[model samples]
Target: MVKHLIDEQINLNLLTPEKTLFTGEVSMVVIPAEEGELGVLPKHAPFATTLRAGEVKIYHNDNVSDVFTISGGFAEIVNNKCEIVADGILL
Candidate 1:
């Protein structure tokens, strides 16, 4: 199906070994990478990175939608989809 520019979204999945924390569509996400905070938007290039202990911010409709605190983890982005495998989640 064809999608309009304004309707574009990225599938975000935040998960831990025990359970899934968040799974939905979002406009953007900010992750704490090894280097620093990394902002991920729709159509972002595919890559993987190790996350630092920090907050994961999910954005939608130009506003912050959800936030997750992780002790550390791994994140991967591919084809407008982002998945985070957290080692430990605080909330």
Candidate 2:
């Protein structure tokens, strides 16, 4: 089991070929995983997966959310950090 610290946030990096879209710590991230939707929090087990075409929801401070749409991409989760490389990101 992953022992997560309270008040700790997950390190998130959203990147596109053109540039890095976002970089910061978030309370959680809801991603459109290939198999299904996936929710990630701090200290999540390491995993690599393909992202589906849909909206990526990033949750931070209570009630705060950032939404982004992407066609497809890849995501890696490890050591409480998630890095996303999207094929296309809709602003």
Which tens-of-lDDT digit does each residue in 3-26 have in candidate 2? 354367999999889888889999
Name the weakest run of 10 consecutive residues (lDDT summed) in model 2: 1-10
Clashes of 2: 0
TM-score of every candidate: 0.90, 0.88
C-alpha-based local distance difference test score of model 1: 0.91
Name model 1 segments beyond 4 Å from true: 1-6
User: For residues 44-90, what per-residue lDDT tens digits would candidate 1 score against the true structure?
Assistant: 89999999999999988678978999999999999999999999998
For all the candidates, what are their Cα RMSDs to the real structure? 3.7, 3.0
Give the lDDT of residue 17 in candidate 1. Answer: 98
Worst lDDT run of 10 residues, candidate 1, spans 1-10
Residue-level lDDT for 63 in candidate 1: 80
What is the TM-score of candidate 2? 0.88
91, model 1: CA deviation in Å? 4.7
Top-TM-score structure, candidate number: 1
